[model samples]
Target: MRQTSYFHTVIIGAGAAGMMCAARTGQGGKSVALLDHAVKIGEKIRISGGGRCNFTNRNLNGHDGSPYYVSQQPRFVRYALSRYTAQDFMHLLDKYGIAYHEKHKGQMFCDDSAQAVVEMLQNECRLGSVTWYTGCTVESLTALPIAPAGYEQARFGINTDQGLFYCRNLVIATGGLAVPAVGASPFGYEVAKQFGHHIIPPEAALVPLRFEKWAEQGFDTLSGIALPVRISTGSGKQAVVFDEDLLFRHKGLSGPAVLQISSYWQPGRHIMVNLVPDTDLAEVLCRDKVGKKIQLKTALKQLCPVLPERLIDFWLGREPFQAVAGQKWADIPNALLQQLGQSLNHWTVLPTGSDGHKKAEVTRGGVDVKEINPKTMQSKQCEGLYFIGEVMDVTGWLGGYNFQWAWASAVCAAEALRADEHI
Candidate 1:
C-alpha cells in the first residue's frame, strides 16, 4: 500500500505563477502544495534582468497604444490582465518595502537584486502556509474516480519520489521550454496533452535569430555594435513593430527590437529593419548630394552618424551600395540615391533559424488559448485542471509583460480553485 498525503490543491512547477497561485489558494484557508524538480525555487526570477529582475512594466495599459503582448487569441489575455493590472503588483512591492526603479520603456527593476523578489514571494507563500517540495521528481499523475469517503473529491492521484499525493484540483504551471539551463521544460505541454487539451506547437520566442554563413559574414565584424532601430514582421493586421535598441552578435541580431520582432517572425518570412528609423535618410542623402563633391563614405557618415562605423563600411561594400562606391555624392544619380535610401530604411533579411530554446527568453506557443478559459485559466474540456504562465499560448513582449502574465494568470487560476472549493 502506498502512503498518501492529501491537499485541497496541488500545483506543479513552483515558478512565478505556481508560487503566486499557492500563496493565494493557501491564504484562502485551503491546504496547498507547491512542487518542483529543482532544488532552488524561483531560479528564473533569480537570473532575470541580470539578477535585478524586470518584475513588471508600468506601461501595461498606457495611452501610447503600443501592443505589449501576443497570442493566437490575443483578446484572451485582456480579462486577466484587466482584473490584475501592473499597478496591483507594484502595490504588492510597495507593501513589502521592496524598492524598485523604472528603466527605459516603463520596465521596473529591483534596486537591489532579483533575490529580493524571490524572498518577497516566498514570504507571501509562507503567509498562505503553502507546503513546498523541491528536488522531487513526479513520476505520474492519474485521474481516479470520485472519492468514496472523507476525501474532498480528490480526483487526481500524483506519484512522486517523495510520496503519493492526492488533490481535488491540480494546477500545471510548469512554464515553457525556454532557457533550459534554468530548468525550463515541455512538461507543462505534455500534461496538457495528457488531458484532452490541444497544444499550439511551441517555438523559440524572444530568442536571437541566426543567419546563414553568407549573412553572418556581413555582421561578424559588426558584433557587439548596438543602436536604436525599428524592426517589423508580418503585414497589415498581422504586422508587429518594435522601435528599440538592437545589438549585433556573432550569431545574428539580438536585442530588444530583434527579440520583439522575432515573436511575430515566422520561418521563411523576411524581417524589415529600419536602420535609420529616427532619421530621414532620403533628405540626408539629398542634402549631401546638393552640389557637394563628398565621396560615398563621407556622405554616409553624416547620414548614419549613430550606426557603427564597421556596419556602415559593410553596407557600403554590398550590393546596390557597391554600385555607388568610389563615386562622389554629386555623381550619384537621383534614382540610385533613392534606392540607397530605401535600402537604409527597409533593409530586409532572412533568418535561417533562432538561437532555439537555449537562448530564448520565452517559448512562443503552448496550450492553445481556445481550449482554455481566459477568465479562469482552466481547461474547457477538463474541470479542475488549470494551466497558467508561459505554458499557455500567450507570449508577451520582451519586457516585463511575460512576468505580468505569470502573475495575472496564476491569480486567475488560484481564484478559480478557491471558488471550486465552495462548489
Candidate 2:
C-alpha cells in the first residue's frame, strides 16, 4: 500500500498561479503540496517577454471596472483583480528587491532576468514550507468518500508517481494550451470537466496571424519591415482595435498589433489595417501630386516617409499601382492617386489561420469563468475545487495583463483556501 501524504491543500501545475497560491496558503499555515510534471518549473515565466518576463501591467485598473480582460463573463475578473491589484504584486517584488522597469503602455519586465522572479517564488514556497513534487505525474484523482483522520475536511485523493496526496482543497492551475513546448496541457480543463464544470473551447491567442498565399501577396519579401499601423477586426460593438507596430513575417503578420488583435479575431473575418495611420494617405498623395515631377513610386516614397523603401517597392509593384509605377506623379490622375491612398489606408486582408498554440503567448479560453466563483476562484459545483490563472477563461490583452490575472486570481484562491481551513 502506498503511503498517503495528507496536506491541507494540493495544487497542480507549479507555474505562476500554483506557485503563488502555494506560497500564500503555506504562509497562512496551511500544509500545501505543489506538483508539476516539468523537471524545471516556471519555464513559461522564464521565456516570457524575451526572457525578462512581462510580469504585470501598471495600467490595470483593479478598481475602475476596466475591460482589459476577455471572457464570457467579462466582469468576472473584477472582484479578484480589485482584491489583489498590480500594486500588491509590485510590493511583493519590491520586498525581494527584484529590479523591474516599465517598457511601454504600462508593461513591466524584469531588469535582470525572469529567472529571478522564479527563484523568488521558489524561495517564498520554501519560506512557507510547501512540499515540492517536481517531475511527478498524476496517475489518477478521486474524491474522497470521507475526510481523512487528521485532515477532517480532506475531500480529494490525488494519486501521483510521487504518492497519494489527500487534501481538503484541490487547485487546478495547470494553465492553458499555449506554448506546448513548455509543458502546457489539458489537465486543468479535464479536471474541470470531471468536477462538472463547463469549459469554453480553447484557442491560440496572442499569436501571429498567418495568411494564405502570403508569398503570392508579396509580403514574403517584406519580412523584416515593420510600421506603426492601426489594425482592427470585427465592427461596431464587437470591433477590436489596436494602434501598435505591425511586423511583416516570412509567413504572415506579427508584432504587437497583430498579436493584440489576434485575440479577438475569428476565421472568415477580414482584418483591416491602416498602413499610414497618422496621415491620410489619399489626401497626401493627391495633394503631393500637384507639382512633383518624380515617378509615382518616388512620390509615394516621399509622401509616406515612414514606410520602408522595400515595402514601398513591394506595394507599388502590386495591383493598380503596378501600372502607374513608372508614370510621373504629375502625369497620374488624382482619382488613381486617391485610389492608391485608399488602398494604403484601408488594406484589408483575410488571415487563413494563426501560428497556433506552438507560437501563441497565451490560450484564449479554458475552464469557463461562469462556472467558477469570482471571489474565491472556486468551482460553483464542486466544493474545495479551485481554478485560477490562464486555466480559467479569463485572458488579458498583450503586455502584462495576463500575468496580473494570474497573480490576482491565485492570491484570491489562496486567501479563500486559507480562510476555509479555519472554517
Candidate 3:
C-alpha cells in the first residue's frame, strides 16, 4: 500500500496561478502541495513578451478590468479583479526587487530576464513552505467521504504517479490549450466536467489570421511589411476595434491589430481594415487630380506618404486599380478615385482560419465562468473545488491583462481557502 500524504490544499499546474495560490495559501499557514506535469515549470512565463515577460499591466488600476476581458460572463471577473488589483502584484514584485518597465500601453515587462519573475515566484513558494511535485502525472482523483459533525477531514483523494495525496481543497489551475509545446492541456476542463460543470468550447485566440489564397492576393510579397492601421470586427453592441500596428505575413495577417480583432472574429464574419487611417484616400486622390499631371502612382505616394512603396505597388497592381495604374491622375474619373478611396478606407476581408493553438498566445474559452463563484473562484456545485486563471472562460486582451487575471483570481481563491481554515 502506498503511503498517503495529507495537505490542506493540493493545487495542480505550477504555472502562474498555481504558484501564486500556493504561496498565498501557505503563507496563510495552510499546508499546500503544488504539482505539475512539466519538469521545468514557468516555461510559458519565460517565453512571454519576447522573453522579458510582460508580468502585469498598469492600466488595470482605477478601472474595471472586465472590459478588457472576453467571456460569456464578462462581469464575472470584477470581484476577483477588484479584490486583488495589479498594484498588489506589483507590490509582491517590489518585495523581490524585480526591476520592470512599461513597454507599451501600460504593459510591464522585466528589465532583465523573465527568469527573474519565475525565480521570484519560486522563492514565494519556498516562503510558504509549499511542497513541489514536478513531472508528476495524476492517475486518478476521487472524492472522499465528508467529515461528520465538526471533524475536519480530507475532501479529495488524488492518486498520482508519485503517490497518493489527500487534500481538503483541490484547485485546477492546469490552464487552457494555447501553446501545447509549453504543456498546455485540457485537464482543467476535464476536471470541471467530471464534477458537473459546464465548459465553454475552447478556441485559439490572439493568433494570426490566415487567408485561404494569401499568395494569390499578392500578400505573400508584402510578408515583412508592418504599418499602423485601424482594424475592427463585429457590429453594434458586439463590435470591437483596435488601433495598432498591422503586420503582413506570407501566410496571413498578424501583429497587435489582427491579434486583438481575432479574439472576436468568427469563421464567416468579415474584418474591416482602414489601410490609410490617417487620411481619406479618396478625397486626397481627387484633390491631387485637380492640377497634377503626375501618374496615378506618384500622386498616391504624395497623398498617402505614410504608406510603404511596396504596398502601394501591390495595391495598384491588383483589382480595379490595375485598369487605372498607368493613367495620369488628371485623366482618372472622380467616381473611380472615390471607389479607390472606399477600398482603402474600408478594406474588408474574410479570414479562412487562424494559425491555431500552436501559435496562439492564449486560449479564448475554458471552464464556463457561470459555473464558478466569482467571489471565491470556487465551483458552484463542488465544495472546496476551485478554478482560476486561464483555465476559466475569462480571457483578457493582448498586453498584460491576462497575467493580471491570473494574479487576481489566484489571490481570490487563496483568500477563500484561508477563510475555510478558520471555519
Residue 259 displacement (Å), model 2: 0.7
Q: Which residue pairs in candidate 3 have backbone atoms (N, alpha carbon, C) closer than 3 angstroms, thus clashing?
A: none
lDDT winner between 1 and 2, please give it.
2
Q: After superposition, how far is residue 313 of candidate 2 from its true place, in Å?
A: 0.6
lDDT of 3 by residue, 1-423 (tens): 776788899999999999999999998999999999999999999999899999888888847878899999999998888888878888888998998898889899989899988999999999999999999999989777764333357788899998988888999999989999899988998999999998889999999999988898688999999999999999998789899999999999999999999889999999999998989888888876877778898888888887899998998998788999888899999999998888989999999999999999999989998888999999998998999999999889999898889989999999999888432
Go through the candidates in order and give the clash count of each: 0, 0, 0
**Candidate 2 lDDT, 149-247, residue by residue in tens:** 876777999999888898888999999999888999999989888888888999999999999999976788899889999999999999988999999
Model 3: lDDT of residue 163:
93
Query: Better model by TM-score, 1 or 3?
Result: 3
The reply for model 3, stretches above 4 Å from the true place, is: 146-152
Q: TM-score of every model?
A: 0.95, 0.97, 0.97
Q: Which pairs of residues have clashing backbones in candidate 2?
A: none
Compare candidates 1 and 3 on lDDT and give the better one: 3
**Cand. 2 Cα-lDDT:** 0.90
Q: Candidate 2: misplaced stretches above 4 Å?
A: 148-151
Candidate 1 per-residue lDDT, tens place, 301-332, comes to: 87788877787788888877787877899998
> Model 2, residue 366: displacement in angstroms?
0.7
